[model samples]
Target: MTLTKKILLGMFLGIIVGIFLNLVTPQAYPTIETYILSPVGKIFISLIKLLVVPIVIVSIILGTAGISDPKKLGRIGTKTIVFFLTTTAIALTLAIGLATLFQPGVGNFQLEGAQFEGKEAPPIVDTLLNIVPTNPFEAMTEGNMLQVIFFSILVGFAISQLQGRVKLVVDFLDQANDILMFLVGVIMKLAPYGAFALIAVAIGGQGIDAILAMAKYFGIVLLALFAHLVITYGSAVAMFGKTNPITFIKNFSPALAVAFSTSSSSATLPVSMDVAQKKLNIPKSISGFVQPLGATINMDGTAIMQGVATIFIAQVYAVDLSMGDLLTVVLTATLASIGTAGVPGVGLIMLSMVLTSIGLPVEAIGLILGVDRLLDMTRTAVNITGDATCALMIAKGEERHAESYSEAIAES
Candidate 1:
């Protein structure tokens, strides 16, 4: 079977098992989900974690070295950052608009103090400084993908200036990357076990009671995610890239699928870069730099969730947000996205920032935390979609030809 078919089946079966586990009494299915099923999920995520640093380091190194002209590389980087920022702004705006319309949190549901602790978000200037690595080796060991990407591009650019060294380093990394990619392929073959395990454990442990309790809010977020994917990303493809929408979607599916299951833009970074650089035929320099940055900062999906969620919370608490307050939510959420890039448990904390900006109660954030993980997964999928979309757009702008990245299955 095709990888896509296998992945799709894995997703389907995982969800089914999760739902079934939820339906069964804990006494009946307890041993299975907790022991066998849950471990599979943990292992799958562990595999992703295992591959994350090496895959990113290798891909970025190879990608940057491929650029013959360092000037073109700079241009690509500028174009990509601009595209990511623009799309992120648009995504936040769309989320606000849809959230205002749907008001996902406006329902009869009791909320408790949620378990959300936020790490510090550095000043914007400081954050930018952090992007430049002081020690590349330490960054890789720590899984500091941003620093790794920055150093990779620099190393690649330096190598470009040396003809003999460029060829030698590029060829070496190219071979190493091929081996790492092969490992990824091997891991993928074990996806079914991972998917089933992860989903069953998450579902069985969380249970449907949690999902059903906030059904309206959950549904609204999902609806907004669909709209954002179809309208925002799709429109960009149609207008800028001049690619067929269905074709773009087909090409982007593998990355999106992995993003959805993982619910982490960072974890999904390697796959997205691969699809963009290899499958889509976008240059490595563009894909490598842009995908990693997008994982860190360009969170269209999270922005949308915050947008809808803020409004939903306001409506639920009967907190009459003035026009000024609504605008505050939009601007705050957008800025918070950039500010909280590396902060842990940022979703709720960012929401709290938005609420405080509008003089709303911080407690309202608790209302949505129950379904946040599920929503987080959906948003991540859309965010990566936007990343790929931007990569294609920049590729077109650079007069770089982009082939369908989804052709990996065919090549395999």
Candidate 2:
């Protein structure tokens, strides 16, 4: 079967196996998870991890080298960021609207002082500070994605400044990107095994009681996410790209699949870049800047989750939020999601921030922690969709910008 079919099959089998393990051989499930499943999942992750730095380096190098005009780079960066922020803001608003309308959090979910520990999210200025690494090697070693992006872009920019002498470097980098793409393709083939093992182990561990307890909340969060994907992403494509939403979805699926499986927008960057440029026909210059920045900020899915989840948790704890408080959540989550770096597990961290902002007990985080991974997969898919959507919109805008520039020149 093809990779996509295999992945779907694996997800199906994983759910079945997990349910069976939960019911029948519960004791043995841990052994299976520890020995067979976890290892496979880790192996899959390792392969992706191995590719991340090289992919970032080479892709940024290629993107920069392709930009003969440095002026275009600044313009591209500004436009990309503006588009990302706007979409992210809208995504948060949608999430909050749906959550409030659905009342997803209005039941008995005890708050019981849930612990929500996370790295202190730096201020926006400090976030900017973190982008430029003091040591590039240190950045890679720590797997600091934004820093890697910053350093790689600098490397690419510097390469661009060289007068024809750096053509060999650019050529070599092109070969490197090809090899990384091949490795990504190979790693994707192993997705079924990884997905199956990880899912089975996770579900088996979570148990049915937890699922039942959070069913309503789960449904609400999921529904909100679905709405954001269909409504927000679909509208963006229909209005901006002037393309059929279904066709856009079809083109976006491969990258979405990768993002779903990995649950890390940064990790999914290479594949996203490839699909955007190759399948969607977004220009290399556009995809390069937008995709990376999207990985950092355009977390529509996570924003949706934060919205529904916050309301769900509040309702469970019987905390009656004022309309003002709900709006506070909407605004904070929206801004926080936009500001959040699109790395794996950062959703939970951002969620924690949202909880703190609204005076919800952090301990409530433990309640959703079990299902967080599963939810994260879906959210990552949503995040990628938003990213891809923004890329297309910005590409369309850039085309318009160029047309305007050309017309102005002709008029002059």
Candidate with top lDDT is 2
Residue 320, candidate 1: C-alpha displacement in angstroms: 2.1
lDDT of 2 by residue, 183-236 (tens): 888888887887787778768888787777777667777887888778877898
The lDDT of each candidate is: 0.74, 0.77
> What does the lDDT read for residue 398 in candidate 2?
70
- What are the runs in model 2 whose C-alpha is more than 4 Å off? 111-119, 338-344, 404-412
Clashes of 2: 8
Cα deviation of 380, candidate 1, in Å: 1.4
Q: Residue 3's C-alpha lDDT in candidate 2? A: 69
